[model samples]
Target: MAHPLELAEPNVIDEELIRNCITTVEEISIAEDKKKEMKTETELHDIKAVSFSFQNILRIDNLNGLFSLVKLQLDNNIIEKIENIGHLVNLEWLDLSFNNIQNIQGLDTLTKLTDLSLFNNRIEELKNLKTLQNLNCLSVGNNLIRDVVHAITYLRPFRKLKMLNMAGNPCHKDPEYHMRIVAHLRDIVYVDYRLVDPEKVQQAREQYQEDLFEILEEEKKQAEDEKKAEDHQQWLDTLSEANLSGVDTLLKVMLDEDPEQGKLHHLSFWLEIIDEIQHEFKGMSKDFIDNTLNANKAKYAEKERFIDALRSSRQKSDGDSIALVGKFDLKKKKLMRQLEDLREDETVKKLRELQDLNTELNDDLLELGLRQMEADDQIVSDFERRYGDLVNAFVEAAQNGFFAKIRDLENAFHTRAVTMATDELEHFAAGQLEDVTDEAQIFLGDKDIVFASLNASHDAHLGIIDGLEDQIVTKERKTFNTLVAEARAESHTRDRKRITEIATVTARNNKEIVELIQSEQEGWNR
Candidate 1:
């Protein structure tokens, strides 16, 4: 063999160095292939996000294979008919603004979508978006949303919705449309990019609380007032009924008495009041007492005049008053003589006619008197029959009963008028009980207290009722004011939400612009 060292070195050392080099190259190649495959999987199967905005990018059809995509943005694109976008099952965000979309059917199957923007599109109707329950922001501005109310209704599934933009649309032309939108839309704070003020919202809340409180207070007051009015009216009704019953009882008692007794009792009752007044007047101011006494005296004088006239007429007409009888006999004789003269002489025809006329007049007058007598007799008998006992009782009372018993007292007062101050005043005040008090006294006091109690009690009761009514009116006004304030507050809230959404969109567009510029710069550098 060749020298051992030389042969071994030539065969083993160089070959081993070459084999190690090949093995190293092979390992490097394998690692490179694995890395390439990993990168390919990451790019094709693990797409986390995608955005294409405000660029000359014409289409998105090539992205259909991105099944693992989570977000897709194609804003400011001149695309049309957002078709086949439902193929993106994993997509959560989709923005295809500045397009020619006419309907919202493309977003129907995007159940997991939380954000979707289709601004500056030609969409006239929003349909088939009922499944987007997780949507938070939806921008469909610069489009023809004719029936925005219907669109909002259809989008009820999106309970988490926070932002909506429909500016530059015809629907905003309605004066109350935005306010109603704020009312119906859940969680939306603004409309057409307008924002609400926080201070205003707090004020509105305070106003609403005040309103609610006012309403409650008012209702309570109204209830109390009604109750009080009912009680007062019932009390008055009861008093009126009692007065009617008392009057009826008094009338019956008077009717059962003899007419003279009835008249005497009535006069005595009035006379007692007069005596009381006279007694009270000794201690009272002279002028007031004198005026009251004079008025009563005038009333009594009129009653006496009426009684005197009736008595005079009755006495004059009592029987045997016969001027009419005397005249009738005289006329009868004259007529008889004239008839005799007419029978003897034919030239006495006029006299005979006159006699006959006079006879007829006499007969008529006699018949009339006979009827009057019969009527008078019937009247006297009927009067005695119906009221004979009443007359007797009256006569006895006037001559020897209650009047007789009080007559001595009156005579004593008249005789001792120089020493009669205390007794009369007491009597006058006591007699006023029936004329004044209706219900039992709630409190015991003197005459002044009684008078003050009646008047002051009425005023106090009415005051309470009036206070309740005022409370009711105040509360009602507060409630209405609160509602109006809430409405305006809600509108502002919606406006804020809309403004925030628009700002966010604008910020995103700006960011996209930066990214596009960087990408362009990087491409240029490459």
Candidate 2:
């Protein structure tokens, strides 16, 4: 562990720093130790990246010769302006974040750029990005952008864009910004670091479809108009061809009675009229059931089937919750086992190893001290001076230097063991935290799914009930229309007069029914 990066963190962009970084191989991280070494040989035309980040640089400079550079990281600097890098036409990824850039300029030539970040800057408006047609990601977060309309107007062109982060901006404070972004940019996958839900996107488009229409470019507008025209044509065709069982046909006939009055509603709003007519039509809710004070016996049976379905769906959810709980229990038990192993087994084993090492060191020290003392005695007592003096000198050198060396080595060994143990514990803790967080999120997501499914089932059952009522009303309307047609056709004498009387009575009855149903519907809606 020694860090090889510069200590002074030079605040200026210069050639020396550039050359050193390009020539020296970046040290591999733990996660990347198995990967091939990064080639740092400075080949000007072949270089792919120049990382000048976290250099305390005040400005971007000295990047003149690197023509093939694709990634340039110049973030975390105080650079006040974007300049002198327009020659890097091959650049695809550029990050000049944590700077003071006010206006988005000098990037018009970078048509191949796909990702760009000017986060934490002073940009007030989003502009000068008409040429970055290939961009798929953009981040201008924590900036000074104020007008959402202006920002969206500029961002809408790059149709290839999928990810956008404009969080921490003044304009993002408004909740409508999120809705508007979803409505206008339907293709984006992520906005402000959150996934764009398709359901929300549909609702937003419906809410703001009119506004979105006016701002669409000519080509897009033409495409939309063509689609609408095609759909409208299909709707007219369906009206003519459909033997509609419901009041859809009857309502059209009533509305079309006056030749001067024509269709004035879209298909969606026209459904409301059908609904009102269905409600006003008499004997609508009575089905094949026999005449009794009650009409819901068959309906109740239908509901029972739906209830069974709902019950089955809930049972499945319950089983999943049970499995999830079991998983949680297993995780809890596994964590307990891990704690026991770490605290009681592994910790004790490591402590014992350290104790044994200390004991061995002390034993060696004691033996050396005894040998030195014995040599000292022998030299002082009767012995040949040459051998005794040689033994004495050897003993003294071993006593001081050997003891200090052994002590230093022992301390180093202990330090290494402690560091390794701590690293292992920290890694284990982080992994466990991640696992728990994932489990929590999974459970939360499952809960959302469960609730959403249950609600959908309820809505579906209610719809089935309404469908049965509509079917009964449709049968009634069909029968009445069939009888009227037969009665008019059968009359050979004064057929016109009879048809006129029958039509007049039908129109009056339809008028009174429409009024009553409209009142009921208004009150019900309120």
Candidate 3:
């Protein structure tokens, strides 16, 4: 079977279909003389990506014309020099590994390059990479680089880098290599050729930073929230009146003392006072009405009695008309005298006094009614003021500062998270490199060159063939483990969030019901 690299690489020299595909309008990547004799009208447009890696083994410099290219891969070839790669103004990725290049002066013009890998080459110095301010990923491994590390003056320009590999080089043998690399290249993710995945490291670091920021923000938010809550509670308590309980107690006392008021009875103690005054007035008025009716009745009774007496006198003096007349006249005189005495009785005098008292009580009852109306009005006004204060307190509690604090906390968390991610990536790079170096030293002690390994330490390294097989197996296992952990964490988080939401909703609903009941009770009492 062919080597994997050969099977994977594009065959640039054969096939008429491939030649036809390379039109002038389209992207055309051909070997040394493959497209030299082709005849066709190109119609390709929007050609932004192209790769010619390990092809055109005999071509020296034929990539100067592809100005529209953005990516070019020319690694694992016999290119002897680095030239004209800077002519492509839009180039972002350039890989020129496994070449005979010994210098690197022609890459200054590719200012747009963010990723550049020149591994397995004869280049000794990285002197021309100063202009690559936008460069993010760099690979300069498998080279005779003795003092290249010392020549790196600035690393601030490549602030966006997330991955870096510098294995298969002598720099890994430096005693303080890990420390120095971590101290300076802070954003690198991978350093040595191993399963040196830094995502977990970055995630842990970010999580820690996020937690720190969240704690600080939460503290600030909590403080503000507590202050606002306290203020709100104070206002609410004030509006409700710290004396509300006392007021309630007093109201209860009043209800107990004056049960008729609690019963909503129309006639209470005050009404009874009015009723007493009305009674007095009615008593006096009754005397006047009764006196008139009694006097008329008494006069009528006297007239009847006198008439009967006269008739009786006449009957006794039968046939003596003159005697009868004298007797009748004498009786009339007696009755007249009795009538005058009856009119001067004390009962009539007492009736006159009762009338006077009744009139005074009626006047007093009117005055009391007016006073009660005024008192009712004042009580209603007091109730309205207290209710308004309660509303104002609730409004104050819902101020904008509460949400602002939450937003600040969120922003601080994000910033700290990104910073921590960068730090962890740096650590991962150094750690992976050091671990691999140590593993090579331990397992391949007498070997001229240490190859691959199962783990990142020398003790984990097997024979070359066994190490490679173990690497494949371990990578698969590690990937599966990471997936499992992520899934479990996600499930736990979801469950917790769901439970909390349900509890919060239930609690809020219960609180609302309680408040409503209390309010209703207050209204009923008032």
Per-candidate Cα lDDT values, in order, are 0.50, 0.57, 0.48
Model 2 agreement with the true structure over 46-109: per-residue lDDT tens digits: 7777677777677677788889888888887767889888999999999899876888888989
> Which lDDT tens digits does candidate 3 get at residues 1-526?
4323444434432333323334332355666454544423322223345445556442345454557767667776666677755668788888788777788778888888988888988776667778787887888888866652463334423667656666666766776454444444556555554333455545444545654465457668978999999997775564232212221122123224432231122111233433443454345434433443444354345436544543453343322433433444354354445433544333334333333433433344334333433443443344334433433332232222222332343244334433543443344445532333443334334221211211121121112223332443344345445634553454356445534543454345345434544554565578
Per-residue CA lDDT of candidate 1, range 1-526, in tens?
Answer: 3222222222211222212212110123457665445434454445555555544334345455557767776665556566666778887878788765676676677788987888877888777777888888888888998776677666644668878888777886766566546555546765566765455445544545664466458768988999999997875564332221121122223224323322222221334544563454333323322333344354345436544543454344333224444554465466556544443344244334444544554454445444444444454344334333433333343335322333343344333431232343344456633333222222222444433433443344334333433443344345445634553454356445534543454345345434544554565578
| TM-score of model 3 (CA atoms) | 0.31
- Alpha-carbon shift of residue 478 in model 1 (angstroms): 73
Clash counts for all predictions? 11, 0, 6
Judged by TM-score, which candidate is best?
Answer: 2
What C-alpha lDDT, on a 0 to 100 scale, does residue 101 get in candidate 3? 77
| Better-scoring candidate (lDDT), 1 or 2 | 2
Ranking by lDDT, best first? 2, 1, 3
What's the true lDDT of residue 484 in model 3? 40
Question: Model 2, residue 132: displacement in angstroms?
Answer: 0.2
Better of 2 and 3 by lDDT: 2
